[model samples]
Target chain A: MEQPVVTTKDALLHAAGALFAVHGIEGTSIRAIAKESGANIAAVNYHFGSKENLYLAVIRHVLEKTRCHRSEELLKHRRDWEGKPLLCSEAVYRIVEEYIQQFFTGIHPRWYGRIFMRIFLQPTPILWEIINELVMPNFDSLREVLQCCRPGMGKEEADLWLDSFIGELMHYVFAEDFLLIIPGHRKLSDAGYQKDILRHVAKMLIRGLELPVPVFLQEDIVHA
Target chain B: MEQPVVTTKDALLHAAGALFAVHGIEGTSIRAIAKESGANIAAVNYHFGSKENLYLAVIRHVLEKTRCHRSEELLKHRRDWEGKPLLCSEAVYRIVEEYIQQFFTGIHPRWYGRIFMRIFLQPTPILWEIINELVMPNFDSLREVLQCCRPGMGKEEADLWLDSFIGELMHYVFAEDFLLIIPGHRKLSDAGYQKDILRHVAKMLIRGLELPVPVFLQEDIVHA
Candidate 1:
């Protein structure tokens, strides 16, 4: 596993990210971030120019760090399938599986997800920029894959299915604690439990979309 | 439409709930709550005893107000099916549909959902009380309905299915803003759009759980 490199800038970003997640940007002060990071207040100004700029940097850092793995997987899938006949249903399953895996594995140290959750719950001016620049491209690519799976599907229907699919996966991210209270529930960190979720959500998406289940997934479709 | 009655106590609860949702408990003060409610600061002490108790009261208010309809619907389902041969699949569908309807209609003025979201994202001691006292009973009841729909299902498997089912619906509540950004997407408050989502999620749960499709829902199961 590659460890994240820690420089003054990285330390500042990490500290600021944690603070911002706990308290909104307006509530978090540069002095607290600096103190937490073991860097001086002057360092924040010198590096990010202003508190708002520091916040923007923190958001960008979070997005880049958390999304890097999923983006790479998406690119690899596209590259591998180039000029080949695509198994649309299999591709869709792979995408959903990979997304769930990335969500659990990629969002490390936990605070990274909290930052996004805070932003989602309490929108800031920067949210629009993040949506347009970062979120939409990823959403559009996923939609394209879904469109391939269900030919002639209108954009409106595709969007609804996409929302439902992503919504299920994102719920685990958002409400992991709440779900843990169920009797016989295992921690999401349990590898076996993670595998169960990955399979469960991917299967849900495939069936919900009415895609023909690939032969590999048919074995797991047995009713409880 | 029945309007929420606004006594001074109700006014205080409403104002405090919104502030707590936005700023969280530690960040919000009784003085601010009193000012927002147009009541004197001493009124907070007199009515709720202290800020912590007031916070507790606000949470109770939100939960009671938001969940009252769903509880009634669940009771109605139980009462209607008493001493009758229950179609388990139909019962499960009705529970899911009524839950979704309650989510949209009962969580009115919006801040109620936000208060829960905030608590979910940033848990305090009250989360345990909420989960054990309020959340678990509702969860257990739903799981019972689900087990009826799938006989011989183990507790663990039933829990997984219940989590996935509720996760999909809760996602719409958590990510309403993100979903709205999709092109051609209608506001969730739009009755037509709400109907589409209610149908989409109900169908997804029915199919994902591999429940026997109730004849009433078969018409909407065609692939796009």
Candidate 2:
């Protein structure tokens, strides 16, 4: 029987991606990448030209994977036989489920988890490119949903609505520390907690984006 | 006359905070903090106990300042005129402005910046306390404002509205990366962008958080 093998360049990018994700772009180095990938020093220079590009390559690879998986899921609910546009919250819910699953259950979820967080936090030129092409497109549908869900609303207002929606999604991503602080990390991961979060976030979006206007919302709108 | 002497401990935290903002938590270290602070090794330990604690202290100090400053601003507004029910959007805008200004400008603002980005991208334990004590209280007031405004909405709906409001905020905080990716960061900071953001955000909240009975509103809500 023959053993399976992956290309050194692929392995290099994979290893480097994890390292960069954990330590960050500047904190990672070519030598470290080479050491992890089991590749020679010169090979890094040959395959990717430099460590920066290699880091970019790693990010692009992960972004591609994440996008593909997410889109595939998004596409699944496309018609449901009736051909009505996907319910806006349901669309978001699909992404939410996949997002939590990919980062929590997948084999290399943790590897990309920190890198994805770092990339969003400390964006690089290449990181921007990935986001522009991949993530932003998905968000466009969200914006559309908000627009339809919110008629007579200006672009700015819809954007804000989406902002809150994204923030809720993000809380899940960054909630570990908060969970620990609330002394809820263990419970936060429990079935009840996960269900609560799912329902809570979903409910918030449904209520905030789909509900009516309020009276006490008047304000000076003046600078403090 | 003796000059107001900045203590070594204070200087160390200040320097470390600034460095951490620029270089990030993992990118920064104790030695770099010491070198930047001109503080002795023993002084670093005596003041902070450990590098991690220094980071936390930096976060705590910066967050306390922001909460206090913001509270003062809100209080000043309230003192001059009380029982002024601000629209959720207006409340959000004022909060956003102060939040941006304080984080972008102030002594040791760098720590706040680092923590701001860190909280979204790489949450830590200290950030949670900052969220609950320093931040959550402010939202609690906003919560009341929402209650006063949207008199008929159920608890679930109001909580949902709050979640969306948070989304609006996180987008601004994390939007630098996304905006740049969209080639919109520069535009976002522009006068037109700010106006657009303010109007849209305010509009969305006003309409989205409306009560079941309906009230004064620029527009009506459209459920998806």
* Candidate 2 Cα errors over 4 Å, as ranges: A1-7, A29-46, A68-108, A185-192, A211-224, B1-16, B25-57, B68-111, B119-168, B184-224
Specify the highest-lDDT model's number.
1
lDDT by residue (tens digit), candidate 2, A64-180: 776525544445455541123235455545555665555444434456656666666767665666777877776666665556555566665566666666666665554444334
Task: Give the lDDT of residue B46 in candidate 2.
Answer: 86
Q: Model 2, residue A64: displacement in angstroms?
A: 0.5
* Candidate 2 CAPRI-style tier: acceptable
> Candidate 1: where are CA atoms >4 Å away?
A1-5, A23-32, A49-51, A68-86, A219-224, B1-5, B26-32, B68-86, B220-224
| Candidate 2 chain A minimal-lDDT segment of 10 residues | A215-224
Query: Candidate 2, what DockQ?
Result: 0.28
Tens-digit lDDT string for candidate 2 (B56-85): 787776667666344345544554333334
Give TM-scores of chain A for all candidates.
0.81, 0.74
User: DockQ for all models, in order?
Assistant: 0.50, 0.28
Angstrom error at residue A39, model 2: 5.3
